[model samples]
Target chain A: MNVFVVGVGLIGGSFAIDIKAAFNEAKIYGVDRSEDNLEEALSLGLIDYISNLDELDKADVVIIAIPVDATVEILPTILDKIDDNCLVFDAGSTKKKLCSTVEHHDKRRNYLAVHPIAGTEFSGPQAAIANLYRGKTNIICEVEKTAFKLQEKGMEIFSRLGMRIRYMDPSSHDKHIAYVSHLSHISSFMLGKTVIEKEKNERDIFDMAGSGFASTVRLAKSSPAMWAPIFKHNKENIIETLEEYIANLAQFKELIENDDFLAVYREMEDTNHIKTILKGIA
Target chain B: MNVFVVGVGLIGGSFAIDIKAAFNEAKIYGVDRSEDNLEEALSLGLIDYISNLDELDKADVVIIAIPVDATVEILPTILDKIDDNCLVFDAGSTKKKLCSTVEHHDKRRNYLAVHPIAGTEFSGPQAAIANLYRGKTNIICEVEKTAFKLQEKGMEIFSRLGMRIRYMDPSSHDKHIAYVSHLSHISSFMLGKTVIEKEKNERDIFDMAGSGFASTVRLAKSSPAMWAPIFKHNKENIIETLEEYIANLAQFKELIENDDFLAVYREMEDTNHIKTILKGIA
Candidate 1:
């Protein structure tokens, strides 16, 4: 089997490593606009060789794992080039734009929109690791739009990578991810900015930060190049979620300012249900 | 040496376990208003036995690990009951109030104000673990106010627990901690609250949440009983930091709303410095 993975960064690079392990006989090809990433992925043994878009007809499977904006621009073109028997899928954070771009394409049945719910704060090919998809959730949007044979092949691949699959419409996937994923990155980035702006002494941050602070601020270290497009593609949903988050912060501040310790305590107690919710993810 | 640890929750219970390992010959006594916690601590072998306030005089070392409000109410009394040779210290998140409360006490020389910067989202005696303090920071405020002999002994204990000691004035400690620690907790709790309020489907949250959301919201699960007092005691600094955080978030929202993706990208790029800052913490 020939598998071509485009945009060899964290998501694509990790997929290449894990998929190769799952199917040792599969030949994995790497494609990236960045020469440095292609070099890193190749040196890391994440791909057998560097390939190009011209080779699309030779691939049995094509995985698009780039920024959402880039994925939107290139996904239809990739579909235009792939052979009829090839299965194509994208692993972008926001799915509505890409799914809609290919909604009426001649090869629409060959393409699937997927968001594998996994990642670390780090990025680049160097950040890829084996088993990243193990026990993680993979959301497939508009799966019914894909050909049945390609869907079966996609399910087999996800099962081999140890990922559990869930299906949703593209619009619902965008809304929910705006709350659970995109908003978190923005909150953490803003938190890091606030702390850096207020705290003059970096040494104090280093010495005083406990595990809680570290965990909360960890996402602030994510790649801006990768995330800006996601926030752009899902602007409306992200904006709505951001407004709600700011209002929540404002309400919490008012409670604290009013010396309403009971209200503050109750607010946190109510949010503690996230613990039970997170256990499901774990 | 005989040691007495009051309020055997996460911090106190972990301290009991480590202190016992460090000084095997020391008789560790547990004291708490909560009988269930006391029983749990004893069963976990976190303490040699359960003791009472009347037994304070029998202790050569007294460690008060409780809520900041309770620490303010009880620290002076613990100092008053301890013998002149006994070393008394309190591990509370907020230090300014506690330090000022005992600033002029006659036995102030025998007490040390310490905040060991280590913890998990969970609490109680069952949450205690060995080496919780290993390689973590221990902030000792007003170290000069402690007796010379007791200071040496305190250093010995911190060293044995594998903690690096950083000394600062109580006011400075409270301010820095508000920015780095307390503010992170509030942001996380509020983020969790915002998401919970908006995302009604718990299953969607479970399936959609990536590791970034989990880490960013992890502290929402922390004990409300423990954090409310910390926020109450550090209200001024916390309010100041919280306001700055809200302003930063508002600014980011404005950038996103105006479609200035470059500014959003640059903001996150700047905060990427947190990666270097966190490496110092590790």
Candidate 2:
């Protein structure tokens, strides 16, 4: 099988690496708007060779792994042109609009809407690794819209990559993901901005940041081009998530102002439930 | 030299295990409010035996690695009871109050006010491991107030544990730490609460908490018993830092509401400087 992956950055590059390792006979073609990224992807041996996305004609499978806004514009066009037997899928975060845009296309059955819940703060083909998707969950929304055979093929690829599969409605995916994923990005970016603004003091950030600050604000370094569209497309859910995030901060603030030590302690202790949840204990 | 660590949790137990590994002749005495922790520390070979506060007379060094509120109350008492030759230090977040409360004590010269900037989200004696302190900074405050010989001993221990030491005034340490470390704890806890509160869908958290949310909210699992007092004692600085953090979030929110895509993108990209500052980027 030949796979053509556009937007050959972290996610796409990692997928390419994993696919080749899992299915040794598979050939991978890389695509990107940036020549530098394509060159890096080649040097990393992430793809068999560079191919324009126009070559989707020869692809048994074509994956769109770009930013959300770009995916909306490019996916329908790509879906329109692919061969009838070709399987198309998107690895974008906001899936509702993308699913809706392609829903009526004659070959919409050829496309699968998936979001593999995996990524690093790092980006580009340089950050790609062979097993980035291992043990992680991959959410497939509106699977019923896809041809059964295509869905089966996609599942085979995901399983080969060592991922667990989850099913959801696209709109519901956007709402839930806004709370879990988009909300995290906003919190981290704001945290970075807050510290950078605070760097007006004598100590620069390098001098002040330890592991704690580094971990909490790690996502602040994500691609603005990538995240801006997520926030834009998932605007309502993002807005709702942000309101809750800001409110929680405000409530904690009021507790601090009141010098309510017991309350502050209890609040933090209660939230320590996060440890259980993250570790899968909860 | 022999060393004693009270409250052998993540911080204390790590110090005990690492310091002994570096100095093979080191004898360690474990003391904790919990007998279970003492037993675990001994079983982990973190200490020679579980000892009492009175054991300080026999040891050359004593470390108070408990919560801030406990440290403020118990540390001075331990200092007063220890032999004049014993070197004492603390590994708590807030130092101004800890330093001030013991400023006039006769044995204050033996105590070194320290805040080692290293820890994982895990806690308890079970979390103790040697080498946790390696490659991390150990900040010592109000060193001039400490007796010269004991300060040298403390520095020797920190250096042998593979730690770099930086000195600052207690007041400055509290202010700067509030921005870097304390602020991160607040941000993470609030984020965890916000998502849990807003998203009635728990599976959303399970399915959508990619590495982004996991990293940003990592510190939310920190011990509330340990952190509550740090926030309470450093109440003023924490509140100030939080206000700054919330204000940054609000500003970003406004930029989003106004459809100022350029501003939103620019801010996120600028904050991306944290990558360079954290030594995270190549």
- In model 1, residue pairs whose N, Cα or C atoms come closer than 3 Å (at least 3 residues apart or on different chains), thus clashing, are none
Q: Candidate 2: deviation at residue B191, Å?
A: 1.1
Model 2 chain A lowest lDDT segment of ten = A200-209
B1-282 per-residue lDDT for model 1 (tens digits): 999999898999899989989997888899999998999899999988999999999999999988889989998899989999999988889899999999899999999999999989999999988999999999999999999999998899999999999999999899989989999999999888888888765555557887889999999999999999999999999999889999999888888899999998999999999898888565
Using lDDT as the measure, the top candidate is 1
TM-score, first chain, each model: 0.98, 0.96
Q: What DockQ does each candidate score versus the true complex, computed on alpha carbons?
A: 0.82, 0.63
Q: What tens-digit string does per-residue lDDT give for candidate 2 at A170-245?
A: 8989998987788888889988887778775554434545788888888988999888888888877887777778
> Using alpha carbons, what is the TM-score of model 2?
0.96
Clashing pairs in 2: none
Per-candidate interface C-alpha RMSD? 0.9, 2.3
Per-residue CA lDDT of model 1 for A95-169, tens digit only, reads: 898888888899999998999999888888998899999999999999889999999999999999999899999
lDDT for A235 (candidate 2): 78
Measured by TM-score, the strongest candidate is 1
Question: What is the alpha-carbon lDDT for the whole of candidate 2?
Answer: 0.86
